[model samples]
Target: ASATERVHLGPTVTNPLTRHPAVAASGIASINRLSGGRAYFGIGSGDSAILNLGLRPAKLADLHEYMQAMRTLLAGESVDYKGRSIHVKWSNNQIPLVMSAEGPRTLAMAGGIADAVIVHSGLTKDVLADTIARIREGERAAGRPEGSAKVWAFAKCNISDNHDDAIDEIKMALAASGHHAFRHTLEGKNVPEELQEAVRVLQGEYVTSQHEQLGETRNKALSDELGLTDFLAERFAVAGTPDECLAKVRDIRDAGVDNLLILAISSQTDDLIRRFGEQVIARI
Candidate 1:
């Protein structure tokens, strides 16, 4: 039996430039069926997945169109995608479409259409509130009811008794978060002025090929070299000992984050999950 109730394929790339919307929809639908209707399709406008392929991330317009086509196809309806009418014949699954967004426009668009949103912005109270407000704005603009789009706070987490080691393990993950969160624009992102330049430097230096790789990778080195490890950790991760993680999680919850999507990117991810489940989750 599956340990979790739902399985999500992404925050994977969901742009016309990468794959046909019908193919993406059909793939997720098959997962939904095989998982007994417990699958969610999580999408994003290409990051490492596209960059590694020597392609640019999808423009907002293309992402919007792709999302609409995926929604229609998954709903067992036909959609005109790039002058081609397509539909997923055997898939009529009500798969919840989750979107990962960091920038204001993307977040708003996700709120307007996605069944749920994974906010990859930051974890600070002000940032979270602002992000949610932007999502709500999108919902209103789309004529959707308040709270139509569920919000999930995206965080990098690692739990261990050795606090220092825990932090070290998550540096690469934090670097990935910073690269994603601040890559497009820094405005309205709540990044401190002092660190803005550093963020830019990190963005330019980030190696897409080494993304999320454990052990001493170039991306992980960038976090320290840019003097952004602590800041990135504070803004995007919940690491350290079990108590430390618990406190941070509580703070995030208090900031109105009801749902969390934790990225377990450490080498000891399995152990971290077991520890988190027992020490932090059990307490919460």
Candidate 2:
């Protein structure tokens, strides 16, 4: 079997606020052409990209308008954007448009417009069900057919023979969820009160430069102070032996998620990818 069929390549997310819609459209279109249409465009309000620039994420209304403008430009039609007309001369709008959504409003908007929706929340039955229901509500409101928008679960996976050690690996990455902007997304999930309190404290003390990083000095201190090493290890990540991870993957698949993305929680990203492919993915 060819490796191509299993690989779908594209940006995880790009925002309308930082990059202009025409530029974004051109980038996605070029990737699609280069990859022979295996590219998908996943857009969202900026997270680290915008936050690092001392800016806020794009508004939901802006994201919707931006998506429309991108589609128009990619379809060879001139778009009236930012008081100027713009167009992409050589591109086809064949790439799938996905959205990396977290909140209910953004999730609904993605349901109505995007070909797929990616959620960063951990894989739990109740959370997955709730997220899917919100998206379905948006679809019904927009009169889109059932299953028109696919739901993808993005899980930070850290697998090892020692289950506890594997669980420990994702503690740093889980810190991102504790940030004020993203903290609410985990509110209604099956998180413990103590852990929630820890996250609240973390929101006050998080360093922007160390956002979503692993094994850093700041992260280690934070993890130690809040005692989040074991608390979030189980709830926010797919961490365990290969067998255990496979079981979690099965649960996610059975929960009606269209895709499961394993965000490798390791310094050696390439090694993790290879190991995951050989062990967990092959079994799944």
Candidate 3:
């Protein structure tokens, strides 16, 4: 918390199934207080965290209930659960709740309640537009003001003068898309019909142990076998010169996404961040 004290810091995601709502509230609240209220909490139905434990993601209903209960607890209010009421006396309720969602239903629910929605879909204009539409549906359903929830597009970035190298770098970052959850989101569009079988094979054989680890053996093998490295890189990452990356980000912003969380995809991490921040972010 101290290292990122001046910036907004929080877990990328937490789930209701593994951690109780009251406990989640307490932990996030502690960080908010420790960071002098600079905390932002993100929640989801669970992915690697739960999957590694052989547990399934929580249901939408459970996510909704748990998020509400967490909010109530953070506000220092007592909440009824199981057979008793619980409260966190030290909570300040200052943390902003963000929702990490991919599917339409979850995206809608997020817009209804979350301060922000992090879309894991590719940062294409079409995907951004579709994601925003779903969030608007939720906002309307909850009677919230239009555009109440800010949207963030998640993309891997490896910008450089050597465009080809930049593109190659992102291929390794494709580990994040090894799972069927991400592939299914792109089904019928970004992924072609012929590639569907490859995606299915990954759905069944994906190595959970290598989840999100760049260059993991299984991910590399699948990417090579199905030629998914280039395919996924073209659809999911931002690579090339700084100017090119900036243009892509501008388009995404114009498509209604409020922010971009660039996951640096490079062996030269420090240099990439320095150049990207100075050349791309500054220009934008």
Give the winner by lDDT: 1
Off by over 4 Å in 2: 1-6, 180-195, 227-231
Local distance difference test scores for all models: 0.85, 0.76, 0.77
- Candidate 3's C-alpha runs over 4 A off are 3-5, 178-180, 183-194
lDDT tens readout by residue for model 3, 1-284: 76674778877778777888788888888888778788888888888788899988888888888778777888898988767799897786757888888878888999999889888756777777878898999999999999899998878789889877787656546655546346445442345677767766766766777765655366656666766767666557777898888888788878988888888877788999899899888988
TM-score of each: 0.94, 0.90, 0.90
Give the clashing pairs for model 2.
none
lDDT of candidate model 1 versus the reference: 0.85
lDDT of 2 by residue, 85-185 (tens): 99997876667888887777877888998889987645677778878888898898899997899998887777778987776666667666545224445
In angstroms, the error of model 1 at 122 is: 0.8
